[model samples]
Target: MPELPEVEYTARQLRALIVGAAIQEAHVFWTRTIGYPDWHDFCAEIVGRRIEGVRRRGKFLLLDLSGDFFLSIHRRMSGNLLLLSPGWQIDTSLRETDNAAWQTRGPTFLPPTATDVAYSRETSHCRVCFDLADGRRLLYTDPRKFGRMELWPCFSEAEALHGLGPEPLEDAFTVEHFAEELAKRKTVIKQVLLDQSVVAGVGNIYADEALFYAHIHPLRRANSLNASEIDALREGIISVLALGIEHGGTSFSDYRDLAGKAGNNFDHVRVFQQDGKPCVRCGTLIERRVIAQRSTHFCPTCQQLIAE
Candidate 1:
């Protein structure tokens, strides 16, 4: 999953590259990826529209068009918004036959073999590709077929964007707010962190990192947290998320930036995916277990449940 930092970084990059650019056409290879207004109506409304701005709500990317419409993208798991410049081909296999130099390269598109299942562009899982007026192509790739694209008439509180929680990076998400939200839940702290309504865009990666940093066991009940623990959690969430954005987001898995580049945050994560590795803080072996049916990682010694 792209999570908050990845989506935020992609939005910022999109704002710089495509804002004010007009869409000449849209080519959606997969119909299921379209979530609203029907594919026919969607393509009709999107073509010729100039992009106004790009923003992110939760994990969804919103492209504000010149008209009242804006496109929202949810990169469910393995989804990526990659750009293909005028002469660039995502599959570098073409480079093998041509003498043209590869101007820029970030991530590979087509797989190495047919058994890899990236068969062809028309049959490939690159769900949506938009032809921009500037001769650039915006590609939406998802091997798992979990990416979603929808055209909204307007940004309505009662419409498609409903049920979203406050962005942790925003100034409005104060320590009091995070603590209050935690106070209302009796589930394990890890589950509370994973809840999108509690705080939007947090997933398994940051949840584990935050809990590890706060020294709170992932299995600890949310309501069992004391004031100091809650305060520590609040700081942990904010600080970790801010650092993730600074590092351009974690890319240990399918995530890649606008240019198909892997982010450097994966190297900075202290707990998530570091299971069986020695903890940097206390040299304790980090452990991984399931909490709330999600893979949870932590340092058993540092994140002691006895605090409750």
Candidate 2:
């Protein structure tokens, strides 16, 4: 799944490529990808509009159009967005085609493949395509079909987007705010951070990484923390999220950047998927367990669970 960083990267890429382009047409291959207004309304309303800008709120990508409308996309699991010229052709079988390709020519060619080609003007797994006036195309593709594409007059009407916590990267999401939010939750610390309403844009990968960084066990109750622990957690959450953005996010599975390229952050991961591997800090073996039904990885030596 493409987490916050991955989704943010996609929005940034789209801003650079498609912001000024006018929508010549729109193609919706999968109707279910749009959550509201139905498929017919989406096509009629979005076409002929020019893209004003692209912005990301939490994990959702918002494309500001010429009028009051916006196109929102959520790449839930395997969703990706790719921008390409008319001549671009994606070969999904390239992994088998060249073993050294990613190592040698990988940087140049991979980001596009990480892009969602599910929707295109030509052949694609693209669920939606926005044809630009310049003959360029922006495509959204998700193989798992869990991704979503919707058109809205304003972002507030997208019920799922409303009431999300402040973005961790934003200037408004202060340590004091995070501390207050945690104070209100009696749930496990991990669960509190994972709650979008508590602090938006955090998911399994970042939640595990943040807990590992704070040296707080994933099962520790949210209200159990002292001021010092809360401070540490606040810093940990911001730092981990910042690092993930810097590294283009962790790409253990389907997560990729705007160009459809894989991210290298997986190599820098501390404990998320390093179970059974030696901890980088203390050489203790990393462990994995189910926390809130999600596979969580951490260092038992470093992160000790607080007793109830």
Candidate 3:
């Protein structure tokens, strides 16, 4: 899933690319991708609307359109918003022909394979297509079909974000707020952090990295955290998320930006996917365990759990 930083970076790039562009046409290859109103209504309503702004709330991308409409998109698991240039073309022939001549011709002459040709095709599960007035095309591709696109009035933005917690990067989300919320939860700290109502936009990856940074074991009960531990966790969450944005978001798999480029944050990760590697802070080997059915990674020597 594309978490906060990924969605934030994508929103920023997309804002730069399509802010003033109007939608000439809306095509729904998969009807289920429409989360609000009928698909027919969605298509009719979206046409001719200019994209005024692009922003993110948690992991949801909000496209402010003309006439006070907001298009909310959630890339649940394998969804990606891809932008195709005005005159883009796919050379399907490259995959069909032998292409041995090009192979030996040089690296610059190498053509895209059949896989590349079909990456953004309808056959590749491109659910929705938006043809912009500028001649650019925006595609919503979701292999799992779990992503959602909904159209609603701008006045309903509060309702749309009602259940989500405060944006961690916002000034309203102080350490006091986080500590107060933790006081009521008896669940493990990792699980509490995963709760959207407690901390929006924090998925498994950030939770693991934050906990590891705070030297708090994933299994520690939320209410057991002391003042210093709470402060450290708060700092860790903000630090990692800011770093993620700086690197354009982490891409372990499936996640990519508008240009189909992967983020480099995975290279700087301390323990999210480094289970067998030695800890960066300590020499002890990192370990992975399943907690709340999500993979949890930590250095045993640095993040020992205290019995409460």
Candidate with maximal TM-score: 3
Give one digit per residue, the lDDT tens place, for model 1 in 1-308.
Answer: 88888899999999999998899999766677898979988899899999999999888899998878888999999788877666434554534654233212212454445543322332234677788899787888877777899998785524888877898888777778888888899889999998988888898899999888899999999988999999898789888988999999999866778776789999999998898999999999999988899988999999998855
Question: Residue 132 CA error for candidate 2 (Å)?
Answer: 1.7
TM-scores, all models, native as reference = 0.87, 0.86, 0.89
Consecutive 10-residue window with the lowest summed lDDT within model 2: 102-111
Error of 1 at 242 (Å): 0.9
lDDT of each: 0.82, 0.77, 0.85
What tens-digit string does per-residue lDDT give for candidate 3 at 1-308?
A: 88898999999999999999999999786678898879999999999999999999999999999999999999998888888777544333432364543222111111145444544433245678898998778888887878999999999999877889999999877989999999988999999999989888998889999998899999999999999999999999999998999999999877878877789999989999899999999879999999988999989999989888
Q: Which residue ranges in model 3 land beyond 4 Å of their true spot?
A: 88-123
TM-score preference between candidates 2 and 3, better one = 3
- Estimate, for each residue in 159-186, the C-alpha lDDT of model 2 and write its tens digit: 7477788888888788788888887888
Which regions of candidate 1 fall more than 4 Å away from where they truly are?
88-124, 155-158
Regions more than 4 Å wrong, model 2: 88-124, 155-160
**Candidate 1 residue 192 C-alpha distance from true site, Å:** 0.8
RMSD of each: 6.7, 7.0, 6.4
lDDT of 1 at 305: 82
Task: Assess the local accuracy of residue 143 in candidate 2 as a C-alpha lDDT between 0 and 100.
Answer: 68
Give candidate 2's whole-model lDDT.
0.77
